[model samples]
Target chain A: MRLIAIFFGLIFLLVGFRNNQSIELIFPSSWPEPIYNDDNYPLNEQKVELGRALFFDPQLSSDNTISCASCHSPYNAFTHVDHQLSHGINDRIGTRNSPAIFNLAWQKDLMWDGAIHHVDAQALAPINHPDEMGSSINEIVQKLNKDVRYKKAFKSIYSDDLITGERVLKLLGQFMISLVSCDSKYDRVMSGKDKFDEQEKRGYELFCKNCSECHKEPLFSDYSFRNNGLEPDPQLKDIGRMKITQNRMDSLKFKVPSLRNIEFTFPYMHDGRYKKLTEVIDHYDRKIHFSNTLDPILEKGIHFTTNEKVDLVAFLLTLTDKNFMFAPEHGYPKDFFDQK
Target chain B: MIRSIQILILFFSLGVRAQDSIPVKVMYDRFEIQPGKTILFQDDSIRIDVVKFYLTNVVVGGSELSSGLLFDLEKDQNYLLIPISQIDEIQFTLGVDSLTNSNGISGGILDPIHGMYWSWQSGYINFKLEGIHFENGIAEEFNFHIGGFLNGYNCERRIQLQGSSNVSRLELDLYQMLQTLSTDQLKKIMSPGKRAMDLADILADSFFLR
Candidate 1:
């Protein structure tokens, strides 16, 4: 009996030890399991804290003028709102609009064109891009190595003071994965905690009828590449998915961005062509350009009444999670920067 | 007591067997067509600055050997040292397999920090050969980064070499590849496509057992 008790105790202890190794990814029960394999990069508080610090620090950039947070601010749903296109180092404008950086654990590919397959390698694009940070991982590592704060942070987490590109990228990924925004009014309504207003209810009905196929429920995105019939800009003849696949069928098919927090992430689409939700609705309603590889769903233009359009816009506003936007934990680590 | 003694002897024998296996060294030597200071192909004089590629799924004698290794001509440290005996036949892929390319945040040779990985596109640059070739008294740079793991554009090549040795020295002659292409038509190939696939084919053919 004593031996049996000891064996059971040991089993319980082992289970507890395994549970402590991984930090749970806080997400709604309704959502599907995240595509990112947590085993590759197990979540921990120390790593997440280190990642958050790195995200706000401009030292990652060549000129130390731009950080990941420069384009992806906390207040604006982690996306730049002041400009249509993303402004990189030295005031150089990027081709595409900066997408929101929330609920990224669910996403399979990053960027407008689905160029980056993994979230871990996504930071390398902007870091190496001449117009963006204009910096290399080697330069960033050198800078981080010199900093006492970074050295101490890395030592605490990894139990050693060594800082490598893999460590930096993985830690940054941890911070990104922690940016979960599931506390919106829409989420509340789905959870049976709150009820939608009459306007919002009508908007939800219209959204389900017209846009739910692509702008899916729960996540508000199917996350597939589709050419929604926007006329090709002569200046920036940016063929989206075709650039990667080199397939003619994939021409102009950009990743369908999530409509969550659309109220704040203004200047929509890949190129930031539409400034207003009404304009986006207008485009969907009347102005769908026919193409060889255009999405079949968008072939028959979605016709929306002006009143219905107003209701849809009202429904979209419910997606704005104020708690996530203004969360003190997600914001710039003031104590960390202040100490330095 | 007799069973314990037998187990100890078995363990000792296994340890001795493990130590007896020799480490197979895979060496890479880069060379031009002509044996001289300056690398010359046809009329244009060139210089080979760098040559790097990934060797994956290395199988010897119809059995699995080394999983993968990165070989860089510029770096002396980049070489495979496999602990295997009697290499009768060798088969390996020139580029990274599709599985490793899709698998995120791998360590060692496949790490993104190695500079072999394509940041924009989530795939490894299977083969990278960069150098400067002078054309009409003007120095023109040539960079061929071969990679594409997707269907239809998969540039990974399967190479089978017949050899049996503990230490195999593979010779890559850059001159033979340069001879086929004109300086004007093929200056640089950064992204993966038909051009990259064609150049990779040339690179695979350039390898010879020495």
Candidate 2:
């Protein structure tokens, strides 16, 4: 085993010498360590660029219409805002809303129900969903293998043009792991770079007191599944975590999404029932339908006056990192695709 | 230093050592299964288009042969050269375990591109048997994509078989698996659940050392 390790080590160094496009994860030092480790899955600039191109390419779908960016647009923190529930190819509607994608390196589980445990494997869900992309990794790889551009890109990175499901999925994972959103107003305030105004200050206190338990600070989420007291939609009848676990206690429990970029990633919640951030606050304030699996912290129903509600919204708005949403590198790779 | 040398020696002498290994040939019954060929079974005839299964943690003579070996009877040769002299007892899991499922995507036979993986959910289809099952002069298609790694629903079964030194084959009776299925299970099984678990048990039970 040691001999093999040394042999592989020599090959790794030789490969590393050939490729000088390796990148590093850049985020606030004060933030907790991201769950994604670079030991097994290293970050590379070329691979990330390849992943970004795949992210925006519609060829990934069965009919070559819907891409990952169709629902997860970079402008809306990688989430669609036009529809409450996400729609896909042939105008077919999915059951749940498309959640925002940022700071995913810290996320332990993907999707509202925490079904996908790995970031690399998360793309399979929508890609294979009949209502969504309606495509398989096998089908996508066959198409990608035929494309000269994909062949060239893969050859440049892997030193060969062999495109497989593992490479495609891992490349997508590389791009997702690269998405780090820490430069919010709240982050600046915490770092002593900026100060909150009177209204914002009061709202921050309320958030810390009431919301911080589940939507924990720093990352803005503890990444635990919880029934935050949204009454189950009669039509959807989506039994969130229970579908995965098959346990009665996990019924109606969905993953607590990060509130970062909360201003843009609306229609909120698992089913996207709440449209505005104000409506989301109002749900907690008044409309929390108690159930057996409802989050115990929200059982008592925190009462915030209209004035306090406005202040809370003010603080929530500060969580938006405009730089992340509008990052030129994160946008559609027009130049990459426009090339002959 | 000693361990490193031992490993280097073991690696270099693998080809020489493999001569002593036992060759285990897989069979449908008394005959080898040919893809796309109609075969007689009890009172009916069935044509197997695809028969794929994962034989994981293949242990022969207390030595593990492979971590996971995906067997595609249509695509692969119907034999395994297990790296052991004589098999007193052989033990292996009939499906990919929960640990591999939780670890996510991997390369080689475990890759999701093999079509053994479920895209909507995160798991591998341990045993995939798709064929036309003929019953009472009626032809019907059957697709049993059995797999689940979740608690209470995990379909992987640890199977052990005892054999003498002369035993050169392991036979799996597809007819036995067909007998275990109910009318509802004869059509299709796409997802993991109680039904998949039941089918996995039947698939595991179908194998015997000869």
Candidate 3:
């Protein structure tokens, strides 16, 4: 109870800074510090509102077909829950899954391959991918320049100016990084306010022994590249990190993902192959695919009984953060664009 | 004394070791641009601005060049730096460092109308030249976007002077380049592969920091 009060008190301090556009969440006291230093791009509600509008707006696309929300739906933890692969404009299918986007401020790299080196530049991949938004920054800028509201948004933060690509990318990155989801049920247990049940306790112990090295504690990812024994797809054939550097040794290696709220962000992996966590564990136990670049953690798969799988699933379920998922402040900013 | 060696040498190796903060300024020497060619102005075609270059470790020769560049502290300023005794004083290529193209966007430097950006692609334009060309008495307009970020053909480079002086600028005579490279070669280079290499090599050979 004291921990929860302290958490809310810190949240209040952040909110006191909110009117100045600085309401960053204080992750549980135990979690490691975030990689995102908000000092460079301080939180501004006006910019975030503008960024959210741009995020949900189709005007960013070349042909008015898809926004970022097209593939990564907010209701599904910002991931496309049904489709195995991401679909973009013209209903064109992409090669990989639209990974859930939150807790990004802690991420050192982005994209399945870490191809887009900078967070500011990540939007360009989806915006310009032929199968995705299919838009050019020049063409997009010309459109935004004409919109009266966008011009107003641009003027409010930046001085009298034309809407440039840089402003759009930077503002959008600010909003994305602000989507931190650190207050889950698992977080409460870790803070010691509440204890896990017997099943959850057993599962937590098993997970610590089996998965904590790669999917480490607190943030649940080591942020290093590893190959988890999945074979390359014949068609998609994504080289993961290797594609970015063109290094043969990095073949099949991928960034280990955070397990925070993993229950909601399903059909997992770089390709969205397993629709359920059971299949993922099953692959680990019996269906371990062979590859030279496989992560040593899965070299000899761990066999779990059905009860163990159930317990593991129970442990993963504790990661859901209803506070972050439905926070009113993060919802669509009705004040800014509520149609006066 | 041991700690002092670590601190002084650490800061000193960058040639920019804070020698009372030398102030350098770039001004257009003015050259006419013509057909059949392009000029590089930034590190990538995606985020274009020749004025804002990141000065990383600065060193002038052989082993010094490698160690210096590999360890630059990265100063955020505009304009390229050419070491003295590296090249002829009359030429320069107009774009970003080769490694910068592949490094992709990391900072707050991607403004579009500055005319040197391609946010969708992972690189910046090394050179951007657009004008009409004339080939075999035929008039033709040309646009060249020469930049290779992922591929080894990356073309952003800085030239050093033949004498002892630290300076680099391309006072473009766009007219001279048009007159030099026939308009036919101008229209051929577009999406930053081999053709970009040839044109960028030409611009690199031409530049010297005077």
Candidate 4:
């Protein structure tokens, strides 16, 4: 009987150690459960730390100059703000603006064109894009395997030093899924921790009347592809979602971006056409180009007074989570690099 | 203690016998109509630089052999191991199924890192056959990437080889597939669409049991 007790105690300790390795995702009660299934890629501290290192490492690129953080910088809410279109290796400019990365746990599809369906598969696009990172996952894996720092990190975390492309992508996914931005003033108000100001309150009401149908609440996005009536750029001639579905109706349609961090994540739209929120409001109010594929809600076009526009912009500001934008954990893993 | 030792010996003997019965090899042959170093297609000398594809759901004797296997002409994994038993017929898919393509990230042959998947699209390129054809002493490149899983665009082909042999050889005749297309029409096809589906059908018909 005593022997059995000792054996059971050892088993319990082993289980406890394994459990402690994994971390749980936390969010407000009002928010829906994340779309990314944690069972497929469980959240563990070691994996997340490794992912953060890879995220900021320029070695993932062919020239070893561009990193995931180059376009998706955390300071700018994980988006490049200096330019309209994203710049890649050899100063090659990509066709579309780099979309902000946040609240990705709820995103079913990624990219402006909704080309990638899964977040786990998303990093491969930029990595292999000739105009982007200009590197292959195979090449990245070979490089990672040679590094003494990575070998030690892999062994300590995965208990094996074998570095494969799948492990690299999955670890990156773990870090990306950990980027949950739900601590905004809007989230605070929803949780009964704070109240919206008068200007912000009016803007919220106006937003519900005009934009909430597509850019929904709490998460600020329904994660659907829609044609927002932007005229096609003659040079790019990008067909947006139609390139994926091959349907004429999906032409000019793009994924609805979250209004969270709208103040910082600009210039706006897939092409970064509008430089200011006022310009976006003006486009929606009167500059909307009529098209067959345009979203029915924006068919008549929104009518916003100058004063109303200010209020709406004020409300959009409340969605910015300062805590998330400056979180130390999401920044560059300085200690990991210093140790290396 | 005596009984347990006897049982262990019995298990060890059974394992050795199982290993001894397992077949050593299953060969795959890549041919171009005629057996030679250079393949003549439509009077043009063609050299196949690469031929990569996936074989999934290999069923033998009503049991699954393995989930999938990637066959690359450049690699040395052309042969496979089969259990030494009656294999009534070998059934396998020429491409990955729709379920596997939609199941997010996968490992091994199904991993996106293999470059089999389209970076912009969500589906894998089921078959990739690249070669250079010398037309008037100038080398012309031809690439055919066949893959599609969506409705009305599914390019997966199911093949059944009917025979029982210690070494089964599957032949991929590139010349036969090229006969379906005119030389002028043969260019590049890297994305999945109508042309990819059409070529996928032609490629599927090019396979035969030898």
Model 4: residue A313 alpha-carbon error in angstroms: 0.5
**Residue A162 of model 3, lDDT score:** 65
lDDT tens readout by residue for model 2, B29-130:
667777888888667787888888888888877877754567787664545557665668988888888887877787778878898888767788898888
DockQ values, each candidate? 0.43, 0.44, 0.19, 0.47
What is candidate 1's TM-score for chain A? Answer: 0.93
What is model 2's DockQ versus the real complex? 0.44
Q: What is the interface RMSD of candidate 4, in Å?
A: 3.3
Residues A1-340, candidate 1, lDDT per residue (tens digit)? 4555687799788656644656778888889998888775678877888899999999988999999999999998999886878988999988888999988888988889889887778888888888789898778988999998988888766647988888898888889988888999999999999999999999999999999999997889989999999999998889999999888999999999899988989989998999999999999999999999989998999999999999999999999999999999899997787766
Candidate 4 structure quality by residue, lDDT tens digits, A90-169: 89999989999988989888888778777777888999889989999989998999998889999877647998888898
What's the C-alpha lDDT at position A317 in model 4?
A: 92
* Consecutive 10-residue window with the lowest summed lDDT within model 4 chain B: B19-28
As for model 2, its CA RMSD to the true structure in angstroms is 4.9
Write down the lDDT that model 3 would get: 0.65
Candidates 2 and 4, the one with greater TM-score? 4
Clashing pairs in 4: none
lDDT scores in order: 0.81, 0.85, 0.65, 0.81
Give lDDT tens digits, candidate 3, residues A1-340. Answer: 4555687799777656544655665566677888766665676777777777878788778788788877766666667887888988888898888888887878877877766555667788888788888887667889989888788778766646567777787778877877888788788887777889999988898788888899888888888888888877899878888765556778998888888878888889989899999998888888878788888778888889999988888898888887877776566656666543
- Please tell me which predicted candidate would have the highest TM-score against the true structure: 4
TM-score per candidate: 0.87, 0.87, 0.70, 0.91
Chain A fold similarity by TM-score, each prediction = 0.93, 0.95, 0.90, 0.95
**Superposed Cα deviation of residue B108, candidate 1 (Å):** 2.7
